[model samples]
Target: MVKAKQINVNNLPISILDINEDDYFCLTHMTKNQQEGSKIIEKWLTNKNTIEFLGVWEQLNNPNFNSHEFGGIMSEAGTNRFYLSVKQWVERTKAMGITARTGKYGGTYAHKDIAFNFGLYISPLFNLLLIKEFQRLKEIENNQYGLEWNVKRILSKANYHIQTDAINNYIIPTLNYSQKKEWIYADEADLLNIVLFGCTAKQWRDANPERSLNGENIRDIASINELTILSNIESLNSTLIKNNVDKKNRFKILLETVQEQRRTLDNIDFIKSMK
Candidate 1:
């Protein structure tokens, strides 16, 4: 599954494609703010330095690369009459550094190194933003797979379902003992919401109308650390409910817990140390 991930640079959306476990960033997407996107790709492809770099990269990484054919291409490179497309370069050098595709994720895509070089050639400022955004995305990706990361995120979501089930069986029964007491359920849910998020879910939606309109609530964008704390509070809330801890007392304790966790997690110096 080769999905496209987008990052914005200079307000232009650049797409990165993953094909065969390697990243291929779209050169076409990178030049939406510039004139002659394809021509710019062609200019980069024909440069003597770019050609040599591509050849060297192929030599180091691509086992089946044809060096004799690459030598022929090098002799012709840098001449005004010389021309190369990604397909031609790949075909000539037996290179895997770039690809040319022609569908939704189409256009010239290059290896990360080549993409960075092309990004710099476009604009150094854009290149800086590109790297920053790319690294941010890569970090997000890592968060989904690592064991410690999975344990925390999964614990939060899993415990939430458990709490909801307990509420359905126990808490809702006292509210008229009704089968369809939906607001009763909502009210209890918001008890935890107010404790952790400092607002009811409705208040969060109202405050963030743009995010709400897009169907994303406060929980959807919580930090990993916040989610970990939320997971902790869920366990405590579950125990408190079973023991019949009054809502007023629960709120005070939970609010204190939220503040303590925030002080620890939100400190800039502490976050830098983790990195």
Candidate 2:
């Protein structure tokens, strides 16, 4: 029940119905002005070819897809006396995805992957037009997301330096431990920094070796994404240290968290580019 957004394509505002959190497809209806288009889609949806296409897509993408349910839908498709709406198909087949609802701006939509197949049913030219529009929309969305990401990266960098300085001044001096012990703790901090920034403190230092001895290195010059991840890692590590959690386990958790964030950002970027 995710609220869907509408996208304008060639002056026509098309609703993007969500197939999942990250994926969507288009829909239109069969009113007098659009009956031709609607009939084309209906013909496609109820056809044996369409049923096969849907079945194959479900099998490939849906782990919980009910084959028996889909079989029932397929069995009833394409009879003059048997009319099937999108809701019926979805409910009957227990489909993970479907286009539903109609009347007054309601039309047929399918998952983007499914829509592409429907496009072919309309006409090669229509399919090409839809693909081009979608690609353009994706590009716009990606650019926006990328810009947002860059901004986030910048903020993260600034915050990281602030946090690091606090650690250096307030936390580091409080330890009565020897230099070796201090260095060991510093090394642990550096490990988390490296995981986020792709460089150990020493490596960063060496890379910018020409800088003044007191100058900040690469870790201090992190992008917003790295800094954001680093901040979370720092907080989590602080708690883990307090809880006497093993460094190895903490590192694993940190890496996994970073990986998940990266994937989410990447998906957003991907979706935006498709715009």
Q: TM-score per candidate, in order?
A: 0.54, 0.58
Q: Give me the displacement of residue 74 in model 2, in angstroms.
A: 5.1
Q: What is the Cα-based lDDT of residue 52 in candidate 2?
A: 76
lDDT of 2 at 126: 63
Deviation from truth (RMSD, Å), model 2: 9.2
After superposition on all C-alphas, the RMSD of every candidate to the true structure, in Å, is: 16.0, 9.2
Candidate 2, residue 98: the lDDT equals: 62
Number of backbone collisions per candidate? 0, 15
Q: What's model 2's TM-score?
A: 0.58
Query: Candidate 2 lDDT, tens digit per residue, 1-275?
Result: 55465655445566665545644556452122354755665666678778878888889878877899777777776677766566666776666656665554355567788877866776677667768877886787677766755665565555545545545554455565546555755676776876777777777777787762877666456654565576677766666655556668877887898888876654443343445
lDDT of each: 0.80, 0.65
Ten-residue region with minimum lDDT total, candidate 1: 266-275
Candidate 1, lDDT over the whole model: 0.80
